[model samples]
Target: MTFPVVGMVGGGQLARMTHEAGIPLGIRFKLLSDTPQDSAAQVVNEVVVGDYRDLDTLRAFARGCDVITFDHEHVPTEHLRALEADGIPVRPGPDALVHAQDKGVMRARLDAIGVPCPRHRIVADPADVAAFAAEGDGFPVVLKTVRGGYDGKGVWVVDSVEEAEAPFRAGVPVLAEEKVDFVRELAANVVRSPHGQAVAYPVVESQQVDGVCDTVIAPAPDLDESLALHAEEMALRIAKELDVVGHLAVELFQTRDGRVLVNELAMRPHNSGHWTMDGAVTSQFANHVRAVLDLPLGDPRPRAPWTVMVNVLGGDYPDMYSAYLHCMARDPQLKIHMYGKDVKPGRKVGHVNTYGDHLDDVLERARHAAGYLRGTITE
Candidate 1:
């Protein structure tokens, strides 16, 4: 039987990239976005403009599609449950998606499952933070809102009681976690199908600036073979335990002592795995679509010895086209993917990926090309 259409809830860059993947599978991607200005709307044929919370809008957008999934984890669990009640197939259903939506719940669940995570608590008020810091062994813990936190927003580092008052007054519950002293951060991207088939990509090291990811290096240079296997095994274990279908991205921290700790979870295609687009035999976007549709998963083999991806943060760049030309002129192997959004300071406007031998050289070349794209470097 021929496959049916796939409906995506958010039309951000993830959906945009997924649309590119679905095209080759002969599967149509119909997106429900807020406006035509959304990143995916520019490239896809079926773009529905509406609010994600509106059932009428969702019902309209979901018409005739065999399966419904998300580019983001923001869709309310109630909304997804409602669709399931009406016989709509929701990949990585509400049960699994909830683990990504609420950090408090996720931490609690993972702790019960024996996953190693940072010391954390659900704080009702800022005073709880002060007491925790005073009573606990660690000071200056990380404060994160239980929900709606992303890209460094809704997160804070509090060293003293004075730093906790704002959240207390705002009536927002928070998760106070002991700050981890780690050597580096890494992410493992794993995908699963409804039939229990799973595949894991190479563990990638992420470079961060102010808690935002700036670049990713696949297979994490100089990483031990044992560590790579452990990362992949942990990711697969989480996926099976959570019964996660579609994609599950586990962000981990390698502590100073060389142990890996789970930091965060994402149930969609993630920024950390963008290098898979050009570096892997099958891109993550493609695998996610296949998983949601219950199609056979593809191999997650790397295309070359190394792959480096650098994020393009928006800055004061006048002629981005000229910068693009410069990158192509200097390094013809670089593949650039830019979201069609107006540039602003610190926003992720695009990314550039380079795949070849020599991990260090690939990373340096990618960073230099990205600097040009950001108008930060002349050559």
Candidate 2:
């Protein structure tokens, strides 16, 4: 009758939500947080304030955990290897996690597998960037830091060589890519177990504002059935190819010509799948725990015909709790999840999920609640 213990490195909101999912299953969730105030540290009973980059700290945290996973991918890869050498299980091992950690590696690997992606190159210097732009789409290219970039921080739309210098300041290799002429962005999420069992959730349409996710809608609007299936297949194929256990999120771009191109990869419960918490038959967090533990996965079916999730960004109004009464009174269907974090402008402090049989109604409900919480919408 011993319940398995799962240790998650990094104490962000993802770990917080994963802890909530583990509670019902009676599984133990341990946190290796950088600070006592980190999102999950405030709630989880077992919290270890340690730097994930330190191999000694990581080894100490994994002492009794059955499996080690992550809330973020910034951990030193060699530290993960050290844990594996100690006979501890690391779901989506360092080999698989590297592709998500380094954009350059991700692109090269995807290209080798013939996954549809925009043309890209690893530039040694700014001049190499210019050469890539000259040979490819020419000017207005996207430049990204090969490692350690998230949200909108490390991405740049460079129309000229001068515009690309900022990204190189981090001393990381720069990845130059053709700026995709996409009509919209999409995401396909899947989970795989160690036994090779996997499940793909319905494709979702993700909206971004300044490179940060703003909202997500399940079963993307106007998506052709064939194209949706293709995206799912591509995501599932990638999980198998990389031997990725736990969750895998494939960010994609839908071109004007109706083709879907791979955009990015996240080997954890992603913002795009946040709608699953209340909209699907089983939440992504629950399945992530099951997958990493090598248990049978829960069904990925949607409970409602349409589900829309809107991110609540921190704004001038710091006390979002005040708006809760109005949001719930107006729409009891709204499910609001507020992370335990300080309010900072443009920070993702929480999100709202709305589900129903009608798409437009659910979309409006989710958006309005999120907007109200951010103080962008009055009444």
Candidate 3:
């Protein structure tokens, strides 16, 4: 009996972890990577070094795979459509993925569906950005390039039109939105199979540091139960409406006024769901694979009362072996997952997950381990 082949485009840590998840099930992975050194390419045995942007390269890569998936949203939508036209199943097909690829499209579609979102509009110029601001709360408006931005690279919170000019300079369509007055950020993660079976993980509170995710707390301490249910239902509805057949992460803003507004949508495994690696009955990567394969969904229940995941950002220290020893010896319960990437300042090299009954202790343990690994905490 031969296992099915899953073609994963892009070679980031997401693909790396997803490949690991498939190991137990004997699922074969074919990876298309930019370089042999890419995170996933280092581990996936069948690596094809090619440019995902090149149609010929993509066509060659998909020839033998049973189905195609992605480590990121950057793949050209037309290319995905082309693959589907060739009878290759692309999980989270182009129609649904285009929304995540383009901010303007996502905002427009979400609005049409009556989803709660911050006031926004596509702005053509700095003057238009100012006008958009005036239409809302004014100044300190948020500007984002409609495509190709990630990890806070294509976003700006500008106090004036002068500050908004940079986004338009990229020559991409720019989306202007009101700066949400949110108390904190939240994430609702759900997995959907092609046949419509779906499961929602507990809502999680995600903390960002300079636009990059730093930490995630499962069950979002003190979150209203009704609102959590609403967020979960909303995510499930979105998956069905958009025809998404894999993991969908709804990045949200829980406003100070007790409202939750949609901030962003990720159509694959996301940083916010990282805690599921150790804290949940099934990891997001494993379930994502199951979903794309149209297999039974897994239980999304948490194993512990509180689970905290802290990202280990690269710092001054390039060699983390010593730090790893210190952290592991100190907290044997800690789970450390590292990507095989060379450390560079501010880059996400790995993460640490800590779970327990007490939220504070869980948070501290995760933070301390991550900090120690990054050389931010000596003791």
Each model's TM-score, in the order given? 0.98, 0.99, 0.99
Preferred candidate (lDDT higher): 1 or 2: 2
TM value for model 3: 0.99
Extract clashing residue pairs from model 2.
none
lDDT per residue for candidate 3 within 46-163, as digits (tens), equals 9999999999999999999999999999899899999999999999899999989998999999998889999999999999998998888789999998898889999999999888
RMSD of each: 1.2, 0.8, 0.8
Q: State in Å the error of residue 62, model 2.
A: 0.3
lDDT, candidates in the order shown: 0.90, 0.94, 0.94
Winner by lDDT between candidate 3 and candidate 1 = 3
Worst ten in a row by lDDT for model 2: 163-172
Per-residue alpha-carbon lDDT of candidate 1 for residues 282-310, written as tens digits (9 for 90 to 100):
99999999999999999998999999999
Model 3 residue 34 distance off true place after TM-score fit, in angstroms: 0.8
Write candidate 2's Cα lDDT for 1-379 as tens digits.
6999999999999999999999999989999999999999999999999999889999999999999999999988999999999999999899999999999999999999999899999988778889999998699989999888888788899889887788888788989999999999999999999999999999999999989999899989889999999999999999999999999999999999989999999999999999999999889999999999999999999999999999999999999999999999999878999998888999999999999999989999999999999999997
